[model samples]
Target chain A: MKLSKEEIAHLAKLARLDLPEEKLEKITKDFGSILEYVGRIQKVDIQGIEPFTMPAKSEGWRPDEAFEVDEATRELILANFPERAGDLLAAPGVFETPKK
Target chain B: MKPLNEITIAEARKLLDEGVATSKELTQACLTQIQSLDGALHAFLEVYADDALAAADQSDQRRTDGNVLSKLDGIPVAIKDNMLLQGKACTAGSKILQGHIAAYNSTAVRKLMEAGAVILGRTNMDEFAMGSSTEHSAYGPTKHPRDPERVPGGSSGGSAVAVAANMCLGALGSDTGGSIRQPASMCGIFGLKPTYGRVSRYGLMAMASSLDQIGPMTKCVEDAAIILDTIQGQDPSDQTTSDTEPFRISKLESRSSNDLKGLKIGLPKQAWQAGGIESRVLENTKAALAELEKAGAEMVEIDLPYADEALAVYYILMPCEVSANLARFDGMRYGLRKQGLPLFETYAQSRAEGFGDEVMRRILLGTFALSSGYIDAYYVCAKKVQALIRQAYERAFNEVDLIVTPTCPATAFRLGEKLNDPLAMYLEDVFTVSVNVAGVPAISMPCQEDGGMPVGLQLIGKWFDEATVLSAAKVLESELAKQ
Candidate 1:
């Protein structure tokens, strides 16, 4: 499929990538061929073939259990967050407080 | 003093145990090698001279106290930057993650440290482990240790080069498609991507989480086994990890003779005619098969009719996973955050400035694949093909114990030879992708060289049958050593 700049831009938007204008043509061309290369799978007769959704049988693992966190590493984790107040992380605000 | 860096992990362990050497000395030897060659090879993203020495001294003290954790204790080991080493910079070779530090230890690094292994430093990799060559690294491409003009097969190229050039005794690398094996082959060493669930993926920067595995790249196969033995086990941190015992090397190395009297090896006929495989590679691969046959192994021609679709399936699935996995890098939390008027603009600006071109390409491709209209057509089709490919391997394994192929279709090409040709680069993983897709184990060991450049022969084995696979690789390695 010949992907137009608009389609490529739409994908970039969905993927949260801000592609530069100059690089748009090349990515458009690349996605075209990469899709073409992967498109070969459409020809393989996959009748009754189940999609391999998991890498391994999940039955072998232990049941969901909470484990103790390494305290020192927890300190490091809090430190790496760009904006944190006390133990809370800071990001763009989602909703404004309603007038009471 | 014999060069400490040149010794294999097994040999180093012996010396350290006998009080013949100290980890500090070995660490110094590796540091010296990096000091001399790293400018040219670009193998290490960082060299932990001080930290390694400190760890080595601790290892020496432990040995003095009659406590050696495992065979790798006190040995210098390098790691691919993709694996989180607490307090170390792990960019995954991407600009977007430049300032990101690993807050916790990846299970492999954690285990390696528990065994008293001194981490030399984090090595380079392809950005997000996407590209075939190390050129995709945000820093720069790593040159092949043998030939500076050529690429060291990548995204584990830095780790493989470190081992090949004696910069480190061994290195930990993650293989999604062929990252570990291809580079190991190009660097002329032994590398293993154990059965998919053999090692824990917790803290490993996931490329294709279902396929990614951490394994060892070593100077010899024994060292690979030793390292894997120390690192492989169930980790509650990673639920996908298999509840398997640690892989032991002694049984594999205990073979009294380099013989394969009753071993059945399969040669996938489709691989013999794979497009883009160089004539030189075919010759080397055929010659190695003859050597295996000479050692009493029976060569059986096998048909993997779906083998040709492996690359397509891998490209589709891996990128789809990459798209999802990389979504966490949004500017909110860490590394290269750019503030814009609105949140959407901030994400766009930060990601634009942070990711390299190839990474962007994959994320976009993945986005396209997993998007609304194309999901079934691309992603679903690919997964079904993956299933078919797995079934094909299962059928082949029923007849043969092992399958053999060239690690890559060609030896390390010139640095820029296929960089622009994305499809050409993707073809590099043709011989190795099916193993990951099928979730089986495979290894690449050094074979004959083509025009003095190294060639690697790959050994594919059934799931969780690493012992048999290593035994077969050992016999074949002995055959190559004979030459």
Candidate 2:
């Protein structure tokens, strides 16, 4: 599995990681070996089998409201954050701003 | 003042019933042990000393009122940081949510509290439960209590180490691809991953949801059974939970070694072929089998036709689910949020800065695997292989009552040995990952030592057959104790 630098960068972008240029070679090689090891899954014959997405269960079951986080606990949770700005946490924007 | 550190939950429960030890005393003893030893072990991400003592005191009062909750009432237990405990930091050992406190109690944690177990603290884990070693934790790696230089296997490393070091009587840990069992194996304790859906996952932070199941890590198999009994059964909150009859673990004692007289144990030939398995590990595993044979269990050589593909399938399926599950942590709803930037940049930069290297790698791999063009090439095909692996286990179980293997390839490695090499680290989970794929129950128990480090033997059973698995583990545990 030969991973090009562009492929690595694309993966980094998808993962939202900031990998500097110097680390690219190392990351590429390591990921290559991992993918090589992971390549073995392709050998198994699994035709026509349904993929299990969640724990098996019957249809149409609703969960009971057993435990709820109380207001005091919610307040404590909100207060614990170091970067809150008026009920909203501020972070670097990942989307384009709306037109003014 | 009795030494609380040395007392088991069973012993403490007996004393509490007999009016010999107060829950406050027991909780204080654990707090003292944490204060004294946890600095070096780094087992706890946050300690709830005051809250724990209060809970313990309430249990004491309940006992005084002749309304005992359960046998484990008043005994303190630590929770893995990944499992939610209302009002406790639930970091999942990542910097992204370093200060995040859970808004609700996970069903397992709620059950433990209902049974009068005090929440001692939150134990560390790999970031998003992604790594084979605890070194991936943002806070730091948890050291093996047996030897500080060696890693306590992860992503449930802290829970295993705390139990091994007697910082807590028992702890709850989630196993997804050997998070519980590997660490239990490395730390010389008992850890069990119950059949998938046997325990509810209502509020557990997701990490490969299909493979994750909450279980117990304790000093002994009996304790593990007791904790399992408390947490197992139907929870409406988690529809995946079964309505299976509650297990009577105390019945295990009456089941003799002769109870296993005709039980067939399968030794998968492919397990031995996995690379990096040390000579001593194989030797100890064989010795454990010999002991099992001496106790009347028959050993059979079995072939898992597709067993070799479990790791690859796991990497694919896990990352795909992780990429989807982790999308909720977009610096919104809850968790660490970087300020002063526009929304889009904030999401990307926060994730980039928040996640560790290994976590980033998985996210990348997972994102790619799930992408439109690659879904069939990777994710869909991996699921097919996963089904094949599960079918292989089903076929093997028809001939053998249980399958046995080395819990890990080697004893505990040095702290930083495999941290930098993700492939080498992922290989450490080779023996344990298939059980997760099969959604079967498995137990990892200390069989012997490689040098001064502990080696673990894994016993895997059919789905929902934790009773047989634990029973067999108890037999092996007693045999090891005798030797």
lDDT of 1 by residue, B1-483 (tens): 558899899899889988899988999999999999999999999888899999999999999999888888899999999999888889999988887778888998999999899999999999989888999999999999878999998889999999999999999998999999999988898999999889999999988898899999998878889988988988878888887665777779676557898899999989876677888778887888999999889999999877768889899898989999998888787877775336786778888889998888888888988989999999999988888888899999999999999999888899999899888899889999989999999999987754478888899999898998898888877787788
Using lDDT, give the best candidate's number.
1
C-alpha RMSD values across all candidates: 2.6, 2.8
Please tell me what DockQ candidate 1 reaches: 0.47
**Error in Å for residue B419 of model 2:** 1.3
Grade the docking of candidate 2. acceptable
Question: Cα deviation of A68 in candidate 2 (Å)?
Answer: 8.3
Candidate 1, CAPRI quality class derived from DockQ:
acceptable
| First chain TM-score for all predictions | 0.74, 0.67
DockQ leader:
1
> In model 1, what lDDT does residue B251 have?
76
Scored by TM against the true chain B, the candidates give 0.98, 0.96
Q: Could you give the interface RMSD of each candidate, to one decimal? A: 4.3, 3.8
